[model samples]
Target chain A: MIRVLEQIGRVFLRLFEETGLWFTMLWRTMAWSVRPPYGVGEWFRQMVRLGVDSIPVVFLTAMFTGMVLALQTFIGFQRVHAESFVGSVVALAMLRELSPVLVGLMVTGRVGSSMAAEIGTMRVTEQIDALEALATDPIQYLFVPRVIAGIVMLPFLVVLGDALGIGGGYLVAVRLMHANPVQYEINTYQFLDMNDVWSGLIKASAFGLILTLTGCVRGYYTTGGAEGVGRSTTAAVVNASLIILLSDFFLTKLLF
Target chain B: MTVATNMEPQSDPNAEPMISLQHIYKSFEGKEVLRDLSIDIARGESVVIVGGSGTGKSVTLKHIIGLLRPDSGHVMIEGRDITEMRPVELNRFRQHFGMAFQEGALFDSMSVFENIAFPLRRHTKMTEEAIAARVEECLEQVHLHGVDGKRPSELSGGMRRRVGFARAISLKPEILLFDEPTTGLDPVISDVVADLIVEMDRTLNTTTVTITHDMKVAFKIADRVAMLFQGHIVEDGTPAEFQRSENPIVQQFIEGRAEGPLTDGTNE
Candidate 1:
C-alpha cells in the first residue's frame, strides 16, 4: 500500500510540475510578444509555414469527415423517416465541434511536431545557448513568432475547414444520397445560429494556443541528444492531440 | 588538495580584472561540478583553462555568459556583479561578450553569410549594404573568404569553426569566450585556429578566456594557463611555470600520462 501510494504521488507531482512549466512558458511568450523589434518578417514566414501550408491536408481531412458523418446520419435518420434532417446535423456538428477539433489535431501533428524537433535540435547542438550568448532572448527571437502564428492561423484554417466540410456533405447528400437539394441547403443554414460558428472559432483559438505552447515548452526544456529531439517531437504530437481532445469538452460546455 | 602557489596572474595591482568569478559552486542533479571555484582575468589578457572532459569547463564558461547561474557565487564583469541582474538586463550585459561553442553551433537554417550577419542585424541599425560589407570583413578576419553562399553543412569542421568565429566577432564585443575551440580538428587545423586566436587577441586587444584540455593550444594562445582538477583550480601560471609545476595531477595531465594522482584511486 505504501509503495502504491508513493507511485501515485509521483504521478501527481510530475503533472503539477509540467503544468507549471507550460504556464511559465506561456507567460514569457506573452511578455515577449509586446516587446520591440516585433520580428514581423519571421511572423509572416511562420504563418505561411504553419497556416497556409496546412490548407490542403486540413481540407482533405475535413471533407472526408463531413462526408462520412453525413452518410452515417442519413442512413440512421432514414430508418426513422427523418432523413431530411441529415443536412442540419452535418452542418451543426461541423461548425460547433468537428472542424476546430480536427484542424487542431492536424496542425498539432504537422506544425507542432516540426517546431519541437527544430527547437530541440537547436537545444542539443548548443545553438540556443549561442543565441543567448549573443545577447538575444530565445523567447523573443524564437517563441513569439511561432506562438503568434499558431494563435492567429488556427482559427482561419478552421474557417476554411468548416466550408470544405459542409460542401463535402452537400456533395454526398445531393449527388449520391439523392436528398432534396433546396431543402438540404435551407436546413444546413437554418439550424446554425451565429453562436455555433463563433463558439468553434473561439475553441480553435484556444487550441492554437495549447498546441503551440506545448511544442515550444517541450522543445525548450529538451535534453539528452538526438534521441531527446525525437522524444520531444513525439511528445509534442501526442500531448497536443490529447489536450485538444480534453479541452474540446470543456470549451464546448462553456461555449454552449 | 595540492594548490599551486602561482594561482594569481601577474597583473598590475591597481587595475580591476575584466572578468571575475568568486566562490562559484554549481551542481547538476546533486552531482557537484564546480566547488568554490574562483578566477580573475585581467583586461586585454588571454587566459586558457585546461581541464579533462566532464570537468565543468563548459559550465564555467556558461556562468560567465549568464547562460547558467551559480548556486552561490558572484560573476563580476568590469566591476559589476552580473549574478543579480534579471533576464533582460543580463541580455543587455551579454552584448559585451562573444562566445564560440565547441561545435560552431551555427544555425543550419541560414547560409554562412546570414549566420555571420545575424548579430549585426539584431543589435545594430546597419543598412543592408553596410551589413554585407561587415560580414565580409568578419569572414576575412577569420581567414575565410567566398564561402558566404554555402550552408554550414557544406563546410568542413575547421571552416565551420571559423565561420562561428566570424559570427562571434561581428559585433566587436569587449570580451570573448571560447569553449574548446579545437576539440574536433586535426592538428594542422588546430594550429591554424590557435594562430587565428593569437592574431585576434593582438589585433582586437579584447579580454579573452578559452577553456581547453589541449596543452599545446593553451600554450600557443594563452597569456596565462589555469588547470582545473576536481572542481577547483589546482595550478595556474604562465605556460613555462605550469609545465615546471610540482603538482602530481598537473604534471600527469600535462604529460598525458595514464598513471598518476589524477587517474589513481587516491584523488577520489
Candidate 2:
C-alpha cells in the first residue's frame, strides 16, 4: 500500500514538473518572437510547409467526415420526417466543430510530428548547441518561426476545410440521398450564424498554439538519440491530439 | 591509490588569465560529474584537456562557453563571472567564442557555404559579397576548397569536420574550442587536423581549449596539457613537464596501458 502511494505521488510530481516546463517554453517562445531578427523568411517558409503542404490530407479528411455526418443525420432524421434538417445539421457540425477539430488532428499528425522529429534530430546531433556557440538563441532561431506559423496558418486551413466539408455534405445529401437541392442549400446557411464560424476559428487558433508548442517543447528537450527522436515525434502527435480534443470541450463550453 | 599531483605552470603574476573555471561543482541525477574543478587558461594559449571517457572534459568546455552552468561556482571570462549573466547577456558574451563539435554539427538543412556563412550573416552587418569573401577565406584557412554547394550529409567525415572548423572561425572569435576535433578520423587526417589547430591558433591568435583522449593529438596541439581524473584536474603542465611528471595515473594514461588504477575497479 505504501509503495503504491509513493508511485502515485511520483506520477503527480512528474506531471506537475512537465506542465511547468511546457508553460516556461511557451513563455520563452513568446518572449523571443518579439525580439529583433525575426527571421521572416523562415517563418514564411514554415507557413508554407506546415499549412499549404497539408492541404491535400486535410481536404480528404474533411470531405469524408462531412459526407459521413450527413449520411448518418439523414438516416436518423428520416424516421422523424425531419430529413430536411440534415443539411443544417451537417453545416452546423462542420463549421462549429468538425472542421477545426479534424483539421487540428490532421495537421497534428502531419506537421507536428515532423517538427518534433526535425528538432529532436538537431538536439541529438548538437546542431542546436552549435547555434548557441554561434551566438544564436536556439529558441529565437527555431521555435519562434514554427510557433508563429502554426498560429497564423491553422485558421486558414480550417477555413478551406470548412468549405470543402460543407460541399461534401451537399453532394451526399442532394445527389446521393435525393434531398431537395434548393432547400438543402438554404438550410445549410440558415442555422449557421456568424458566431458559429467565429467560435471555430478561435478554437483553431488555440489548437494551433497548443500543437506547435507541444512539438517544440518535446523536441527541444529530447535526449538519447534516434530512438529519442522517434519517441518525441510520437509524443508530440499524441499530446497535441489529446490536448486539441480536451481543449475543444472547454472552448465549446466557453464560446457557446 | 596513487595521489595525483597538481602541476600548474609558472606564469606572470600581474596578468590575469583569459578564462577561469573557479571550483565548479556539477552533478546529473545525483551522480557528481565535476567536483571542485578549477583551471585558468591565459590569453593566446592552446590548452588541451585529456581524460578518460566521461570524465567531464566536454562538460568543462561547455562551462567555458556558458552552455552548461555549474551547480555551484563561477566561470570567469576576462575577469567577469559569466555564471551571473542572464540568457541574453550570456548570448552576447558567447559572440567572443567559436566551438567546433566532434561530428561538425553543421545544419543539415543548409549547404556548406550557408553553414559557414551562418554566423557572419547573423552577427555582422557585412555585405553579401564581403560575407562570401570571408567564407572563402575561412575555407582556405582550413585548406578546404570548392565544396560549397554540397550538403553536409554528402561530405566525408574529415571534410565535414573541416567545414565545421571553417564555420567556427568565420567570425574570428576571441576564443576557439574544439571538442575531440580528431575523434573518429584516420591517423593521417587527425594529424592534418592537429596541424590545422596549431596553424589556426598561430594565425588567429585566439585563446584555444581542446578536449581529447588522444595523447598524440594533445601533445602535438597543446602549449600546456591538463589531465582530468575523478572530477578534478589531477595534472597540469607544459607538454614536456607533463611527459616528465611523476604521477602514476598520468604515466599509466600516457603509456596507454590497459592494466592500471584506471581499470582496477571495473575488472574486479
lDDT by residue (tens digit), candidate 2, B24-114:
8999999999988888888889999999999999999999999999999889899899999999999988989999999999999999999
lDDT of 1 by residue, B1-268 (tens): 1122224333346888888888889999999999888888888989999988888999999999999999998888998999999999999888899999999999999999999899999999999999999999999999998899999999999999999989999999989999999998999999999999999999988899999999999999988888888787878888888889998988899899888888877553
Expressed as tens digits, the lDDT of each residue in A1-256 for candidate 2 is 9999999999999989988998899899999999988889999999999899999998999999889999999999999999989988988999899999999999999999999999999999999999999999999999999999999999999998889999999999998999999999999998889998999899999999999889988999899999999999999999899989999999999999
- For residue B259, model 1's alpha carbon misses the true position, in angstroms, by 0.9
Error (Å) of candidate 1 at residue A206 is: 0.9
Q: What ranges in model 1 sit over 4 Å off? A: B1-13, B266-268
lDDT of candidate 2 at residue B65, scale 0 to 100: 97
Error of 2 at A77 (Å): 0.9
RMSD of each: 2.2, 2.4
Query: Residue A198 of candidate 1: its Cα lDDT?
Result: 93
Worst 10 residues of 1 chain A by lDDT: A212-221
TM-score of 2: 0.98
